[model samples]
Target: MATILVDLDGTLLPLDAWNPVFAEICKAIAERAGAPPDEVWRRAREKNLILMRRLDWRAFDWQQLFDAVAEELGAGRAPSVLEVLDKHLPRFRPTDGALEALRELRAMGHRVEIATNGHASYQLPVIRRLGLDEIVDGVRTSDAYRCPKTCPQYFQDADLMVGDNPIFDVYFPKRFGLLAIFYGDWEREAAEHSRRLAISIDAVRPDHVVKNLKELPDAVRRVLALR
Candidate 1:
């Protein structure tokens, strides 16, 4: 038996498919802000950068993100994060293969738990909507630890980590002495979200890279075998 921690956003509930929907959201927000969609993203990114700097990548609510776009664009009525999320709750779904992988891992007697940087306010809703609440062992967010998983010290007693972000999920957890299973879309993420790409993963071999979430069971087996 083993203890395992997995990420939420890209690892289990992949956001790649929601890119278009999110773009539509920005457009709607732009209309409300009376600004161009590009400007909306600029302000959002600007605020996001500052927030990341101040908080060092801890869990952040969607309200915070929406507030940034609204305040920076001087639009008080821009669509809120909850409004958009609630509207799309019916469409929310996790990777089917990943869900099965968790169940299989659990069947193998490994404790599968979610260790995410996403806030409970919204992440919990998705967890419930997707019925993930019944799948995994439990969920632990950054708010619970008072720091993001980017800090190597976050996994003081964990055995393993499964996530997408190479830096925060792979390198940091590995630095903390836990094995990391990298779950990400390398080709799709390259030349865009470099953070999700395994650029620095070469430095750490045998980190257990898997392109498909379905391969998680074998990866976990490999890591457990190593121990």
Candidate 2:
């Protein structure tokens, strides 16, 4: 069976699904330090960006962000990363049409797996919470792979890759010779956002472009047919 490697965040799940959970973590950290949660959270986001710049974007570890924010807040007590994540995972749901696509693809005898750039502690739980494990063959993470999806070796066996990230999910996978699908509505991205970025999404082309998860099944089928 051919392997279909799909990105987790922003593909199987919404990108900002962790917002409320991160808020709760920040709130708890602030309470320990007698500081405002919103201010602490804002600073945490800034700290996260700074840290992210120092490492490969795909190798980003949320635990590192949590530790940085906790240290800055002078938190007397902080919940463990796993503790915070356990509560957070419940907030996630599979993206629209993601579940159906996975099921149909697997029923078609394709091997479906998640290839994500994330910390496994939280990422794995989120997959389970979203019921993705029901149809998924397995999952791989940057943490386990020691490299971002930008590296072709991240998935040497993937015949097809799908995700919202044009750079990592679509462009890189195509370089690795996988049939690619650029999912999500890229047109909604602000012009100013592109102007500020070093490289625009338009620069990284995929074999197929899909506007939503609901379009993914057909896109995948069409790509497979051509192969």
Candidate 3:
């Protein structure tokens, strides 16, 4: 049986839509802090990117980041900000064909696993809510190891369990000898993102490039046939 590793954020769930959900949470945070909504959004977004860019994932906690943003706006508003975020958890909906694709992969005898760069506390609940637990055999999150997917060790661990590795940062997974499946809408976009991120997707090249999850099973089968 082939073990299939999948990404959660844009790959399984539709994060593009979820950005507004986050934005709403930020807006609420800003309102509670008594700061102009735009100012709060600007500060939080800037801080978020800075924290995400850190090589050490443990250096920041997203909840703490929200709290700090609230503090920067002024104290006595952290609780309200957290409440706003907690309420928006239900906004994380998977893409249109995601669940159907997961079912097909399982029915076809693939050992599906979620290999994601999110915190387990956040990722697992969304997976469960989307009913992905029914299809996936297991899940790996960056929070578990206190490292992001950019770390080769995270990929090494995933490669040990699943033969199918979804390419997020190609160089990281390639270093661990996993077959890369570049999941994106456009080859040009994928290529550019890989280059800017300092990852080498071209060297391994992706075994497949899928625009949607519905195309994944056939892509997996083709790769397996070649093997």
Candidate 4:
């Protein structure tokens, strides 16, 4: 049996309200700072690009970005990003077929783990709230390890990782010998990120790519075939 790692957010759970909730968070912080909402958002995005380039994916709750924006705006006190996320938590139900697919993978005797860049402070609540805690063998967070998936230790003894992020979940771990299942098509995203981040992302490809979670089990089967 192979050890497998699965991503959260767009992989295990659907992130339907991500944009609107984040926008509202920025607006609230901007209101407190007495700055234009666009200015606050721009600062957050700037900080996001910097963190992403450094492979720091631990702040999925956007606390780091929020703090940076508050500092730049001198907000003194910023609105709680987690509070906003909590209100919209219901919108983050499991992605269609995700639970079933995860069960299938585990039933095959694979050691399945929820490996995410998200901090446990926020991500775990959602996992448990939606009952995913009972489905997987364990959950792993970059915040817990103090490092992202780029670290070799994170993938130690793991045969594969399935996630939606082209860079963090796929490209970064592929070099470490983990087969990959990218949950979506990422050609345009890869090219755009290559230019936007000023990094060479050419020739990055996962062992399998599935646009639907229902296809995930078969994708895993194909990936395991390579082993």
Candidate 5:
């Protein structure tokens, strides 16, 4: 039985539209608090990257971070920040090919799971909304494990998981002795960063490199063949 763990944001969904939706949500929140939208966006982006890199997802909730940022901007908002965030959940859209690709992979008898970063309050709805709940056999969100993909322990349970970082992202599955796939799209800046950092997307030498979900089933088969 080959288990395949998949990524959520950029891997299963197209981030081009999602990024702007996120920006719009931040703008809305900033406007409500009478803060500069661009400044709020910049600060939030910086903080999020810092948090992810530091693997601090478990230490803070989105509401706490938002409130702190709001306070920094002289707003001193409260729980309403979370409510405003909830309103924007419907904005996310999975890639046009995601559902079809997932269905095909499932049909091939591979156990598919979602190994992603983010809290359940925010991540679960996105998964359900995208119909991922129907195709994936399980989900492993950072909130569930109290650690992000950047933490090797988080991937320890995945049968197979796709990620950009061979070191941290691919660590769990590899450590567990499961096949790991490196999902790399050179067209995107983040994928380019993964490449430049020599993060071992290929160096850790994933079982395969898939540019998109459409290529995933074949990659799984190739991995199985090697076994």
Candidate 6:
């Protein structure tokens, strides 16, 4: 059976679910620093972007980012971002048809597993709460592996990698000889999503594209036929 590694955040769940958590982090920082929350959020987001671009994907740490934000704002050890995430996790809902897609893919005889990038402490609990454990064979996170899917070593011996993030989950994994499947339609996506999708499509060229998970099995079969 082909081992199909899947992404969790944008792939299985609404990526916007994280916005509130980050907002809460900024609020906490602002409260401690006696600064405007919007300005604090802007600065923190800028810091996050800088770190994201400079650090190796393996070295990216949320706690470190929070610490940096605190330093930048002179807030001195701001409240835990993990705590905010924990508080908001229950409100994080999976994308439409996501669970059914996993169950159907497994029924089609593929070995489905989660190979996501995020803090495992936060991500694992959300996965469990969403009932991902019932569908996927296993789960792995960047926190545990010390690398995102951008690192070829992130997953071993996978036939395919599927996700919405064009950079980390698709383009990067393609480097390791895994067939890449873009999980969302590019042209129909929002502008930001389309931009990333275009970049990945241009750079790495996915083997298949499925706008919805319901179409995933067919896409996989098509790729398998070529093999």
What is candidate 1's lDDT per residue for 1-227, written digit by digit as tens?
A: 88899888887887764454456667887887788887776776666656554555432655667666776677774565666777777887797687899899999999888888777766788888888889899887876677777665567667899887766676678878888787765444332433433244456533688889888999899888998
Q: How do these models rank on lDDT, best leading?
A: 4, 6, 2, 1, 5, 3
Clash count for candidate 4 is 0
Candidate 2 regions exceeding 4 Å error are 51-59, 76-78, 188-197, 200-202
Q: Pick by lDDT: which candidate is best?
A: 4
- Model 5 gets an lDDT of 0.67
lDDT tens readout by residue for model 5, 141-183? 7777787766666666556777654544465467667777777
Q: Pairing residues by index, what is the TM-score of model 6?
A: 0.87
Q: Which stretches of candidate 5 lie above 4 Å from their native place?
A: 32-34, 59-61, 78-91, 164-168, 171-176, 186-203
Task: Residues 1-227, candidate 3: write the lDDT tens digits.
Answer: 67667788777887664566467767777778767777876776677666555555743355666677788777444444334435766776787677887788788887778887777766777788788888888887888867876676676544322222333445456566666666664467656655544444665566567776778778777777776
> After TM-score superposition, what is the CA distance of residue 49 in candidate 3 from its true location, in Å?
2.5
User: Each candidate's TM vs. the true structure?
Assistant: 0.85, 0.84, 0.80, 0.91, 0.80, 0.87
Could you tell me how far off, in angstroms, the CA of residue 171 lies in candidate 2 after the best superposition? 2.5
Candidate 4 accuracy as TM-score: 0.91
Which of candidates 4 and 5 is the stronger one according to TM-score? Answer: 4
lDDT of 6 at 12: 90
Which pairs, if any, clash in model 3?
none
Per-candidate Cα lDDT values, in order, are 0.73, 0.76, 0.65, 0.82, 0.67, 0.76
Q: RMSD per prediction, one decimal?
A: 3.1, 2.7, 3.6, 1.8, 3.4, 2.9
- lDDT of candidate model 2 versus the reference: 0.76
Total backbone collisions for each predicted model: 0, 0, 0, 0, 2, 0
